[model samples]
Target: MTTTPEILRYAAFTDLPTGGNPAGVVLDASGLDDAAMQRIAAEVDFAETAFVTGRDGDAYALRYFSPIAEVPFCGHATVATAVALAERSATGALRFATPVGPIEIVTTRGADGITAAFTSVDTDLAEFDAPTLERTLDLLGLDAGALSSVLPPRLAFAGNWHPVLVVDDARAFDGFAFDPAEARAFMDEQGWPATITVLHPIASADAGGPRRFEARNVFPVGRIAEDPATGSAAAAVGGYLRAIGAVVPPALVVIEQGRHVGRPGELVVEIPPSGGITVSGRAVPIPDDVG
Candidate 1:
């Protein structure tokens, strides 16, 4: 008899099934080595893939791998994996022991299925020097004016390090373009693990309520030109918002991404009064098999 690994695909951040970031999940990757896991992730060809091994009570030990390498943490993939587990077990709270640290996830079952949300580790922000920022902009083919003064240039981290460059509006985001090779080269020079550039409009009052913000993420280090939905980046943004005092305590913000890729994703970020950030979304299974 032969054994096979179960590979499941789930789109995080969207309940509509069509919209969200797609992640590969291996619920039981007990015997796989690092190289094997990397190969599996590469074969799946999603931005990130998650592999799980042990579970202690409600907590499980998990690892994340990109198509090219292993990442310390991945927020969207975490949410996807949790929801996948909830569908099998029962919808409720689960814990994940990741490379970064232990994370808590809560799941709920609706008419559609189980939806999961994960709270990120404590976040921090740092300032980058001028030369590095200039070099980065040069590689991105963007001028200093293209950057938004409101957000400024900062290195933000929740689990992984991402240099966040915020732009003024959707037009700027839509108009911006860059060579992947050049961007990668700049990141290599700057010693940045990953670089994410986001463009957002100022908050506006609407008839319904406060309008949800629209944004796009450009990820060059993962060998991806752009990510459909980026929960890690969203967590970093939430931390940034808190650091800058943009939003008061106990605020909920919506981040819209992947619209340009035709796979629109929505991420809801909640900031607690005490601390930490919670990112919530849905995951849909992808039909595939792995071992």
Candidate 2:
């Protein structure tokens, strides 16, 4: 408790230090209390900071805190923490005891870097409420006509709840703009951390292609305006696609996020026939001077 904890910085979902979402990892948070953790997270000032409270055998108790408050779960932070742990320990399967549930993480080291895959908890998919949808459209300055015909709006949950919204126009999706304050209010009302907004440019609504999709995640609830890469949201989207029969079993989809903010990163999602969804991406240690 007397010693200063090392806040190692790592970028999740991308090998480049400048790309992907930056997360602060406190490998050992043994003596830190809730207030201390919150203060450290605020000082780090990333989208999310992960603290490893203790380790019981190979399982570690983990918690996520943002600048403002604590969140139930975080996708990118889990991957980053797993990679950080793998770098120090043996690179293999690891379990994390989160507030939501125990998350299984499998990490591997290669020439590219450390790659971590997280298996999500049980997923739930339902039509997103109409009132929330309307409020979101108004806040984003868009109408129902802007929505994609093939991909309907649905509320999806894996570790955290995220409303999946699909847009038709690529140009409009690329130029996404939303009021942060309005989004924060909406998120507070719904108790959601973020909304998954995506655009699939394929002319046909066909399945089985070069698995990739463009996405922008707005996370006002977590006190982050926008996230560069969101693994939980990506996992929810994968489950949503599967639930709607848009994708076949054993599918692999690459999610591209954080383009507008210039921190572009890719997250690979794998959907099994009938089980939990898996999200995979690489993480590289960020330098002390990196923004």
Residue by residue across 176-281, what tens digits does model 1's lDDT show? 7878777666666665554465657546434354436677776664557778898888888788778877677677888888888778988888877645689888
Q: lDDT values of the candidates?
A: 0.79, 0.85
- Cα lDDT, model 1, residue 87: 80
Encode model 2's per-residue lDDT on 85-104: one tens digit a residue.
99998899999999889899
TM-score for predicted model 2 compared with the true structure: 0.94
User: Per-candidate TM vs. native?
Assistant: 0.91, 0.94
Pick by TM-score: which candidate is best? Answer: 2
- The pairs that clash in candidate 2 are none
